[model samples]
Target chain A: MQDIYILFQVAGVGIIVAIIHTVLKQMGKEDIAHWATLIGFIIVLVIVIDYLSRLFNQIKSVFILQMIL
Target chain B: MGSILQLFVIIMVAAMLVIIVREQNESISFLLVLLLGIFVFLFVLNQVEQLFNLFQSIVSKFDVSLLHLDTMIKVIGVAYLTEFISQLLKDAQLNSVAVKVEIVGKLFILLLALPIFISVLETLMSFIPQ
Candidate 1:
């Protein structure tokens, strides 16, 4: 529910960044466009990485609980 | 689901038209087709999750360890995302870069699965009374 929403929000940012990069590249700003793409990727990675880390912790806790039980 | 089918048909028709137009020049038409594929794939992204859950449920019916299942799913995700990124790089004419990224992705996925592999092996070994 909320997770899907957050995921979509992050995906939307990625789409926007890609569009901007494409447009900039078309306008002959290859260097700037590439840098922008890199930044966009970093931003998306940061958001997704946080979620992944949380998921890893959840997986760890669940495994621990199962073992203890 | 019906809409996805419809979109696929539309893309097919568009591709046919592009082929016909190839006599003029294919560069822009090819780009359009590529964009069409991306847009359609994005539109049906939700269906993919349904497929993943279906796979998870089927896999869970087995006696396999959850750690192995999780590792497998993560590896599958990594493979899919790496392919997607590599394809995009290829589209941008960065084939070498795509190859490098794919290698890195494979290494990362291997690292992620190493722990699960070791645990499974140890569990199997202990079962043999060694």
Candidate 2:
């Protein structure tokens, strides 16, 4: 339910970032275009990482696995 | 049933989106895929947690020890988490790392199963000994 929204959000971010990168490149700001992509990557990574941690916590709480990572 | 259909639709849409975005930004495309994978896993994970809670209650009804069930749950958890990570690495094109992650997961599962193994061995020994 809520999870699907995050999926769309990521896809939207990716598409938006792609558009920005290309538009920036066409404007001759190749460096800024690169930075945009990098920043987009980091933003996506942060979102994914936040969820990843939540997932780990959920697993820990549910299974209570002693050898959990 | 409905959720499965929903998941299928989501995956299909996400796949097409990946194809659409792949041309412009490979990294973002990959990120989109990664996020989708995690979402799908988490969706199923919620169901699994519910199922496990049910199992816990059912097991409590029996007079048997819970140690085995606890081990089984741990093994299942370990297997799922590691497989999810390895698959993510595979998606990222790190075959070697994926394989290592899988192997380590199997090793951890084996380590967790040692008590069950010992119990089985003891039973066999009881049957064969003088």
Please tell me which predicted candidate would have the highest TM-score against the true structure.
2
Q: Per-residue lDDT of B13-117 in model 2, one digit per residue for the tens?
A: 988888887887788788788777777877788898889888888888775566689888888889888988898889879999999999999999999999999
Instruction: Tell me each candidate's TM-score.
Output: 0.47, 0.89
Model 1 interface CAPRI class: incorrect
Compared to the true structure, candidate 2 yields what TM-score? 0.89
> Per-residue lDDT for A1-69 in model 2, tens only?
666677677777888998898899899999999999999889988988888787778888777674556
TM-score of chain B of 2: 0.88
Tell me the TM-score of chain B in each candidate. 0.62, 0.88
Over 4 Å off, model 2 = B65-67
Report the C-alpha lDDT of model 1 over B3-116, residue by residue, as the tens digit.
Answer: 767777666765565465344333333343444444454444456556667767877887455556666666666675577668867865789999998998889788878998
